[model samples]
Target: MLPVVLPLPLYAADASNTMVVSAAPAASGLSELDTPAAVSVVSGDDMRQAAPRVNLSENLSSVPGLQIENRQNYAQDLQLSVRGFGSRSTFGVRGIRIYVDGIPATMPDGQGQTSNVDIGSIDHIEVLRGPFSALYGNSSGGVINIDTQTGQQPTTLEAGTWFGSYGSWRNSLKVSGATGDGTHAGDVNYTVSTSRFTTHGYRDHSGAEKNLANAKLGVRLDDASTLTLLFNSVHVKADDPGGLTPDMWRADPHQVASNVSIYNARKTVDQTQAGLHYVRQMGENDDLSVMMYAGIRETTQYQSLPASSQSSAAHPGGVIDLTRHYQGIDTRWTHRDTLFSIPVSFTGGVDYETMMERRKGYLNFSNNGTSTDYGVMGDMRRNERNLMWNLDPYLQTSWQLTNKLSLDAGLRYSSVYFDSNDYYITTGNGDDSGSTSYHRWLPAAALKYAFDDSWNAYLSAGRGFETPTINELAYRSGGVSGLNINLKPATSDTIELGTKKRIGNGLISAAVFQTDTQNEIVTDTSSNGRSTYKNAGQTRRRGLELGLDQQFAYDWRLKAAWTLLDARYRTNACGTANCDGNRIPGIARSMAYAGLEYAPEQGWYGGAEIRYMSDIAANDANSVKAPAYSITSLNTGYKWLLSNWTLDMFGRVDNLFDRNYIGSVIVNESNSRYYEPAPGRNYSVGLTVTYAFQ
Candidate 1:
């Protein structure tokens, strides 16, 4: 799709637009074009312009095949999925590998949360969405790598504030600097930032508040070694409005579900983490790198469950208090050499991670020998200490077989272990403790053929596996006791064919992929407000994605993306005799997005976007559905640069048409309170000022 037009200087390679896939690389490394995978990069400057810069969904709408929905209830986090892989998660992220800087954000059990991400200081985000992502180990349906901003020449201080509808406000401050000159061992750079955000929320009792801080320091040593240290902390308190039934949603979308106020349904989290990275050049053909990180997270949550359910000795109570300590280290060695007289590079590494948790549960009420207060702590129902760990050794290599052809391959051996100790035991609740372990050998391969400088084609295939998360195994169905130790892991084999084409001043890409899954984990039963899971026979998911980015004259740009997915159960699900061919729930079948922006060096700049998502099934049986909807938004801003100071003012309006829609859903809720409504109309405004000094 070549246009008869000359390329402008704006499309040329520059620091701002030079895209790279830092996550998928050999010892010598390779650029995005040379990686032979479906990868995309979104620059920070583009994300910061006329945006809230708060959530990942706000800036990632242009990336095809990624579905993100704002649940409005921050306590539950956002609902995100890549190629229908993680759509079933009720909280946090599943089936994806997330990393910030050089540290792992996903836990050893493959559960991840983005509440700690410092979006204000992000420099760029890289998304890898194909078979190649299997190299990252467990639950890697996709990989997301976020890189924070580095200090520039001349120290700079920035302060910003934003105000939005629903009584929402955000304030932030940042400082960064660099010292010394070129190649010197004493050279250093540092960046520090902090922010506070609060929201009244669109629905009743859904308010939330958060405080976050991040810091990074880098030092060069002896011109052959470098060290970087990173630290981050976050505290959050939020009210869970809970989900609404279809009748309740139709009556009043802004109302909280029943019994939420009585139980004070809420959640609180505090976390602090730090990491260190070291790199050194060995000889002329070898390099070594090492990374170590540790973190602590504390959480306390209250749920709305009836007292009758707690009367059963098997119940785990409605109040949960958990403290988790996690740490990990990774080391790698790379050798740049020739294989059979052909240019080749190889990298081998091992990663070890472990986590321990002190978990306790208590009833939500006390009898007090009189009337019961619904929110007071009554009796301890459960007390347990649990541990989980994983170890993996991986090797990757890339070879240039010919001038226009290349081959890349990798292998990894993964092992995961879990164990728990029960402390609270009585006649009714006997010793209900157990241990389990899982292991797998994962492999990936890809072949790339370059038709010319402007076009490239590739085919890749891989095998992936996902073990049962700790939370998923904590409880069993039918009000049974102890953990579901009989659960099995899910395995998948995927294949994809993709092509990338460079137009005059833009790029176009498309991919077709298919995956077959065995022993797919799914919800088995939801009784007494507790959920459990079991393995399904088999499942299938196939999808197509298309993306385009074009820049025209006069600083105007157009960005668009579209995705079509067909996911279904190929065999009996939920232990049914023959409920095969049912559509998988919680994921939209078709999605589309488009945006247009016009920005110049000076004067006013503005943009508008349109997004659409098709209807979705809400359960494994496909008995209920959520209607499809479309939304439109507009954003505008102005910038002024005078002397050593820069000033920017921006405003945005979401749901410009004020269309009523379901923003997200809780898949297969036992209580049938599945709908989470979107706000009708909303507005936000912000101002940023930066000063540069020596």
Candidate 2:
């Protein structure tokens, strides 16, 4: 029997008014409320009240067991990791699945880039933790689901403007409305935003400029059903000042840019996405939801490094151009409350994706020549294409043995097929690749018991599986060596126990979990003097997470979360035994976050936040470690409410102390190292004025 803690006073409100649909019996797809799984929901009210500055990573730092590494340069990419997963990844998110209103935001190839989510349109965000996530088959770490608001009223308009330090300025406008009579309501929502952000940069030559836009529409059918359409896009242009070595960092943390130029180093990315979703109510106790989505992403980047600093001179001029395109489709069906006395729910889906990428090198005949004018003779063009398909089916059922005891069981089956081809233009050679297929069966079980309204405890066990990504598979190929087509899929089994308690006006939750993985994939650098993906024998990760949310008198609230992880490689078959007992690369052993907020009766509010992360190993060798760092932030706001109009103003200070740190570190095939750094201190202030009609 699980231990049950006291119920917090905040939960005493009317349960039927809860914003989360998954918590209600009408939504049968959910397994259990407190099933020992680390899950949390960020409500729309919280988001509006907090007024985040940049991306979701910054806003979600308060979530337990999650970490966001802001590589400072928007051109490179952001790193989001949970439960010690995806820490080693350099570009794009791995080991985690992202969903928007039940539609997968990540591509079918398991690579996710989420710069398109419009913060203004989001209704809420949900974070699901642990490897027992049979719901999403591709990743084992966690899942982040974002749901946007729809059909609020007949017509609504909102606009805002922001100005801040570093020559940063932003303008945003949104218009949403519903048409037709009550029986047939068609809704449309659109958002347009532009920002010109530049700084002398914490370091020299690190300035960046970006632009983003998103729009969506929803229709409600006469048959009590709904359909939604979405479109999102982003354009980012930035300068790359390059990374600093440890000695340089120790000497001058803000020192960047060895070869500063107006347009010498830069990156540009553009992406367009479209999706459709339909939901229908079949009966009093049954409902169905179907979703279909497709997206196209194109990115181009150029960087110039010092020729003497790099290990290999594929190009004597120290320059490289990278370009990629991605396209994919995802479809899913969700059914609720089907048959018998058993509460039954299930979700089944299929996905298909393709990617085309090429990288070229150029050498300059003279330093006086334009960067673009460099000669392209003997250029290397590596083309890789991946066709990936997967089908996932899952079933979940919950049984109520008594008023206080509940039993939940779930099972999922997955079938995956992948085909890859590589072409080399320099050697005028290419290879037609074969296809590989595999099947996985995962299961989960949980037991929850409630002693009273205030306390609950639960225990759960689940399994997860992941296949190698396209980038890792086609990274290196040659005359004597070939792709590792025989690579096995990584698998993990996890167990968790947790308890939640409500004491007075406060809520506290704690959980302990252990996950063991087999045939883990690790970067092997000992072979061919280049980094290659290899199957590590075995590994284990165990951790403890705690979360606290408290509301005191005078409208004051406090929230805090902490995570402690122990990640290690248990067994390895490398050329040397040095890899054994080493901590997993990229994963910090400890992370913590705390925030305090106060809202007085005078319509004034303010908050402060502190986040900290421990050091992380840069590679399997464990010879180098990224320094630990912490940051502080402050936010304050005021609102004035009149009879029919409302005005609000807010400001924030980020990286309050201007601490310097590296967000991510990577070593490429050339054995040359690169680091993505965190941004320096900055401030943003904005205002919103609204007029409502009764």
Candidate 3:
């Protein structure tokens, strides 16, 4: 295993705040909210204390109703599902929208897939659950908004390093401060960082490596206005061991094959994002913010297939390359005032985006003629272009019926349009072309009542819709009819009731929700061994979520959450009706998390956390189930403050018990008969130090 090197000169020790003005009580509290949805915020301080080793998905595993499945590789295997909405996908994120500083991170073609984010620069994350299409068009499941750190404090210098098991190591440094030296504080704040990560991977032929760089600059125009520029980039190189079949796992979970004939798969991805945000106060009672962003992302991936069931005489061993580009713009406005003694607020926004993508397949032949040899010729080429546009308008009002009672109501409407052009070609064969389009409407409403500062309750309902992604539509060949352009958009309706209560210094929250979806997309393998995508029948999911956060007078704190879900196919005309009543594939019926922490004024702190997930069915047939698993982690840190410098040290132990389990499962692409496991237990740790000048 190669030594893991943390990109140095990119780490910082000074902590930053993560509070956003949008979520302030005076801006839009629970009683004044406009949408029928659930939202939660994870502060930057909280994320720093947690110190996750990987990306956003790993850091958010504790969020209620969220499931993150890490496939251990950098590409095509990371799976993130919310409320069982994105489990059927093969690569990249789907069924949810991800935004950074209000810029759409997901592509325009309904494919919410991308890995351009730099978690180290993020200051806060806001998770909005249920159908929020009325707020963000064309998405039915949920929304993730990431806010990065800006110029909030004076100049400072920071750096850090991390070392742990599996030859892992990471180093970073950062500097940020005011540009002016005197009382005239009209200066800009800037931050730049870079990091490299590597791991020997648990299995043979699975080691991976990555490099990332990010920067941000913020200029304060006035007390009520600011402008900021952002940039981020990442490069990755990794080996693919290929997922193991269910039978292989049961026979020998630790066994890994290393073949001399297997060609090493390699991939490289580059992403650059640039955006400008302007915030201005329209008046004392209203405010408006506008942001424009443009991003370009490119990727090249090569894969060598062994003599698997996917290989054939007509289609021997081969390699494939994929590439893509995306661009978009977004804007929003907020207005608030009193009408007839009742508080009223209005919000509206519009977004436009375009995307272009292409794929090429190559074949190589060996003297032995084994299915594992890469043939010596190009087999196919595919190209696609997609365009999308959305508009949303919403209104919310609240009235205080009495000193202790309040009423809240809201409404929103969303419209979306999607169009795509696809083309395919085979060696010496002519090109085949096709085009398709889809449209949808979504709405949401909510009612909330607050008894006092310590207690609140609410009921909400909303509609959501999702169009088929480009990948599901463009990867078909001869015997395989590619691109289901005629497929209809999937639709969902959800209703939820919840309450939040605070007693003493402790907080408790609970919610129950039910969602019914139609036109769910399903991928099925035919007798010819090619996978086909189609819209399936209806499916229902209902669940309850409970969470508790408490702090003791002695500096001890406890946080915990539990979820119970009932998901099943309600109707299926595809002869798979028996899937009814079965637990949803890729979802655990029950999951729980608990954490204990101790932080005192003395500058020393530590914490321990445990997460548990119940067994999950690998497929709709319910013939196979991935066993339940639990993982424990511990972290500790100490800080020392002086007149000119601040020193700190921190470390953590993941998979404390070293339990073996599969992070995710999927049906084999070549054979309709089996499933594959992701990875097992692993560990990592790191530390940070800083210096400052006033």
Candidate 4:
């Protein structure tokens, strides 16, 4: 029954060590007590404490208003959503903006993936939820910003490894150091990290391998300027175990669909990206910052769609191949001055990003003169060249109107363009080339008042939008093979009331929010493993989120997060039996998490946690549901500090009760194959060794 705490800051073992984060444009450079947004920050050290630092779902479970479900299918990545915005994504991230080291991880088209992020070197992860997120531009239902560890004094070299059930293993190496304070001319600091992970998954025919490398080199050109270079690369190969029917899941959760093995359903990806960031302290009241980046990504996937489905000229084959080249730049200026005797800070910025892609589709089966071979790439059936770009200009400001009142506001104009050229026109297919563009104006503002030094309250409102992604626009109705240029963007207006309090040794953050949307994008039809989208009339969402972090006796700490969301379709013309007033599929109505830990830097430590999720609708019809479930986990570890060398070891056991439950669902899936079951009683043990150089 402890009170909630805002996710702004988490104090260290002692109350004096405070960690703050900058998660939004208008709230940047401000501490937890000064910001007017519901921002959550998780330190890397806290994230990796005696746990496997492989997936984002590990430590991020404590963040309220967010959901991440591990589908146990690496090919599809984690199912992550902020509030309910991204609950519909089947493959990648949507309706959210992601950034790493000041470089955009999400493309201009609003589609993104986290496969390239290296968890071993992360410094912190910040999440901004609700109204203020709109300032980040397109797809901005929320924002996730990740920063890597910076090189520091007393350089260190570390090696870490983990092994667990289902033949899972991960290994990593890291080295980081600094030449000076990293602020004066000629001062240099660098950090490099690399890792390899592999797993024989919990389900049949589900195996995956991943490799990652990350580097950051920073140099201070002068006292007022610093330049940084960042590089990242990732390679992943994984088996895609498609979803199963309810009966099949109940019979055997570990079993894959029959077509998975026959079609050799799998995916392979390779991505490499590099970027440069420059920061200058211009005079005493002005600052300048610039970022430029470029990257290329290639993906090949074999789907379980029936071979016969590709026989028609309008069908996009069962095998997909894509090569994309993308680049972007951002420049901004911030000025601080006094306006009408009030302290104010103003910032203006422009972001331009573009992507060029070559897409080809082929049949998964080949037929020679004599026989047919399944699970082999055949003649190309579809080919096209696609391009997408976005240009956005935004301005943000914060004013300290009085001793107890402050205001933060921003506006952004976002313009996006998409074009496609069909290159595989056959007899009936003809030409499917098309082009389209969209424009939106987003605005957000927040007003806050401090009740005292230990408490604050805020009211905020904003307008946001979500554009159809490239994948969402790749198909149309009637088995058509052209871009769904008719799809329109979904726009929404949101308002929130929140409070944050700093009690004796605990912190609480809580908020209640509601959003109304017009022209909500929804699944129109799904068949033969492909889905098309259309504008469903309207929707409404109201939710409450609460978080609490408290430091108690000894080295013990208590943490809890809870969310209650009521998301429903308000459109009477959804074209489905239950679409008018049904709960949104794939979104749980309630979620709760609580943990108790006795963690210390040295000696022995242990922790235990429990999580609960309410029933979830598995399809738009509401005919099937994933039953609510509760699970518990426990972990223990020991650390030894011996002079220059440090050794840490840990062990974890999940699903302590061996409960049977559904882990995630494939929404609106055809053939009634929407169930993805969870595993029971999994265990892992890990260790890390580090050597400090003086």
Candidate 5:
């Protein structure tokens, strides 16, 4: 039942093979050694061992009820959560559901961004937690799927670079191949990757730059058909180190915030995408699949609101702009026989998504006539045109029923819709315009038992929903300026119990869970930096999790994970006042990780790690906090295999003992500027060069 903990999974990049998880709705897809709920997988050579493969929190810290922060702000991105379900996101990623190869990097109103995942062309990463992730419809609460790296059989070329601590760097290039070996029928396969990154941040008006590109193509046509094509692009510009006031992070956790150098805060982005996938085999128990995608994105920001905070005519300014276009499609069908005699499978799908946006606002200050020019981009208060859409229909099933019992189930029927139009009318912002919609019917189930071959036990249940993101419906809880469109939608219910074992080369796991939510969507005020939201009545989350991984002597390995969460507010909470039962403001009531390794496959290699977090809760009258921290890290690497060329060298050190934490939090920042400081001792190094053609 889930948890091979974090090592053990590969379908390529062969870390001793094992993997199969198609976002787990099942019909044929399960592994974490026969999945039964919470899941994890990392691979891609453990995301480039001795990594600097650029953020994914550097290889997902041996996952355990996810929470990967790192607001070492690339202009706010990366602050994921699960279990406490996205912990009231402060920027991107909301309640999870992201995918890379089969397209969707979450949209259709849920907001997502991994700044274009390109872990140098990854090949694995699948996380799915709790009750089959609500069948992947709105805000699934957990689901991450990224897969890239396929274009096999010889022919290769790679180049890489790395550097770190404050002035950072990254560079990459890759090429892969394949052409015959698909059992005839016009074979083809390919891969391409590109990267560039730069940073000079660790606070102080943070800086950043990024560029990335990716491509994949496959075609096999004739033997049961296949086709694939995908492309990706991203561009970013950043500088926005704004958050810190717990006495300016105890008098300087890397300084910035003097209104962030007087409003020079920043952000910029551009994106491009493409996708298509198809597969067929319609005979012998049927099968079929299809996917399609499209994208466009643009963003601009610059906020540190102050020059009179846009002299309100119902101000919606401080500069922010957006443009978006999106698309999606999915179709699936699957079937297999036997029912009363057990042994079944079934799948059905339909998904459609859409987004269309154009939002604007300006005034970061500029007045000319002898005054003001703070960060330029003056006038034009706000304008809007937004639309969102979603439609889903799904079903999944599986059963074996004997020889150790098994079952899986799913159902989905999600719908979402929103529309807004406004066009900058003002005299106190008239013409507000709005629309709304939401619907749900998600269900899930699971059961598994297998006391024999390496133990297992499981149980699961589900239902989930969350829908408010248009930046939480743009502003209206009292500071009122249109579009909050009467917020409401945040349902939930979940349950889990798990167990796993395989103890020799080692693997062990445990879990216990609970969730119960209703309404639940807090934060109800923010003025200069603009934020507003409400709906909060009941909430709860209870958790416990643990994991371990092992191997010995023959190139040692060991890993560990732990989590315990409580997250609460079970009544009387909405924009403050007698919080009925606090905690749950930026979540974290325990977390831990451990790692050790001695890898092999050329020459000496090494690893070490430790992490812990606890203290967090910076609002909702829990007063304030963001302390509890422990960190340690170290890495080493070397590899060289001649013949066709291969070399890899690496190094790392982080925190080690430097400590002085608070790496993320901004929960109710009406100006208290909730911390975000992390980075004490740091270092990095890297190398990679490869060549092959056979």
Candidate 6:
């Protein structure tokens, strides 16, 4: 369960009607109220005002059926899960689809990173969870769509600054404008922003710095066609404080683990990406859309490893350097018409994506007899080039069965290929080069019925497929060499039933879902700080999600969310017949959140939020656990207008009671250093100034 607290401001452009376009990977043009799948949309202004506007984990608390945990470690990114599906990821996002302005933030190899998202310039966020998500292809446990802010009629220039706890500060500037009148072929609008942030972190030996730039440009080529371009870049440098053992955490929660400073564990990344979207209306009942994007990312990371490990031919070294180039394109056609006096719509699309990486590893020591500089690059030890690609074609349709009922269906065929070439094979090292491919035919269907003007219900079902990511296949168990070629893709069947109701000035929603998986993937073994994977016989996941939004009066509003999930392995595997009937390693069984706000159309506004989560298993065996915890936070802000300029001031406090708890855990960690501590009693203040010009 999750809870969110934010003012009910009329900042949303369409506050009365929730219209969603391209909410899915194949551009499902449907209203939120009419969609059969479980979907939710969060207003950008509400999110920015709710917290410090730093990470997605700050504002996702109000979304039902989703879980996001902040590790307080920028190098690790956020731990995100939809229902209980994506909880096994050790790094980055898995089993989910992430997109920004029609461009995929996830790679073809089923890995994703949200560090490049420009939170301050976001217009809205759409989350889709349930069976229908399988139409997106491999690893589609869920989907997240983020749309950036666009230029309006009046040009605006804005500047902002923020100062927060733990020696953190950020400065940002933005410019938006339009050229010519609002006429075809003459109208062009653009929005550009840049920001820099630095933080000393709450724990010892942990600090991070980030710089970002984002831009979006839109042009109306004609009355029936439009073109949009998006550009984004990010550079980050962060130090890993490392997880702590129970004893270490008990002594000092804010202290770094042993060897953290000695090893100088750190990571650096630079990424730049650009995308173009084109839409054309062919006729009164036909339309076409296309999107193309390309990006490059370079990263270098230093890890903690003993010198003896580096001397072994089987060891992959400690210092990792990677350069990746990725590109993709998607095209779709939509048609609308009437069949026998009944309304019907159809969409067909094709997607293709490719990525190539040059990965290398080196010793972290100088290798000058006894000379040692833990983070410096030394002799090269391992080198590999890897490539991944995917192709998917899909078709979707919606039929108005009657005045109060509708039917939606979709089918997609996905094919993924992986290839690798190892170039640093030596005496005891074998040619670890290998290639693998996977294919699947996914289908989904849903039925929606409107009981009345205030009540609606839906039922949906689908099949999902997930393949091992490149990182998961990189290393094998028992210190074996070569790729994990024996690993196979996982498949599952899912079903969901949900209902939505409008009561007075509030809306309520509830959903129950179940999934059964075959050849389920699970951690096989952990040795020498390295982890491997194996297929289990079967697994089951079921959950319930509930949400509420209400407006009590002119100045008061309430929002709440709760979730109950049960995920477990159903059969024996992992070299132990007793492994059957064990709870999943990463997810909790129960969660809840609630928030209230007051905002009387203007002046000052304030709110508070409360969140709670139950204990979580740390491994497949369920021997170790992370205890349940609760947190509270409060925030307030004021907005005033002067002449043609507007000013805003805000402040916030997190963990008001200063609770000491583990914010996140590294599931199946080899060394028992599983706990990542959250900061206690943090504060932040910020100000923004904006001016409008002709």
User: Each model's RMSD to truth, in Å?
Assistant: 5.1, 5.7, 6.9, 4.4, 23.7, 4.7
Q: How are the candidates ranked when ordered by TM-score, highest leading?
A: 4, 1, 6, 3, 2, 5
Deviation from native of the Cα of residue 402 in model 6, angstroms:
0.3
**Could you tally the backbone clashes for each prediction?**
0, 7, 18, 8, 0, 2
Give each model a TM-score.
0.95, 0.85, 0.86, 0.96, 0.34, 0.95
Q: Which candidate is the best by lDDT?
A: 4
- Residue pairs that clash (backbone atoms under 3 angstroms), model 4: 4-508, 4-509, 5-507, 5-508, 5-509, 5-547, 6-508, 6-509
- Model 6, 1-694: lDDT tens per residue? 0001010000011112222333322233333555677887776776777366678998888889888998888887888888877798876788888888878888987888889988888877888898888888888888887888878768999999899999998888998888865365869989999989899999987799999999999898988887888899999999988888877888999898666777788899999999988878798777777889999999998887766767877777788999999999888776677778767777788989999999998887785677666767888888999999999998887777786887888888999999999999988777778899999999988888889767889999999898888887877777677789898888989999999887777778999999999887778886644568888879999999999878898688898999999999898864754868899888989889999988664579899999998999877788878889999999999988887788888899999999998888888788888888899999999998899985
In model 3, which runs have C-alpha deviations exceeding 4 angstroms? Answer: 1-36, 50-52, 179-185, 222-224, 254-261, 304-320, 364-380, 383-432, 475-482, 526-530, 573-577, 601-603, 667-682
TM-score of 6: 0.95
Best by TM-score: 4
Query: What ranges in model 1 sit over 4 Å off?
Result: 1-20, 23-31, 576-578
lDDT of 4 at 545: 96
Tens-place lDDT digits, model 3, residues 217-273:
877676666677777777776666555566777676544433212555555666777
Q: Candidate 1 on 478-552: residue-level lDDT in tens?
A: 656677888898999999999988887777899999989998889888876678899987999999999988888
Q: Which stretch of 10 consecutive residues in model 2 shows the poorest summed lDDT?
A: 1-10
Please report, in order, the local distance difference test score of every candidate based on alpha carbons. Answer: 0.82, 0.63, 0.61, 0.84, 0.81, 0.82
Error of model 2, residue 613, in angstroms: 1.6
* Candidate 2 structure quality by residue, lDDT tens digits, 165-255: 6566656666655564424555333333333334444455667765666666766664567666766777767666656566766676556
Better of 5 and 6 by TM-score: 6
TM-score result, candidate 3: 0.86
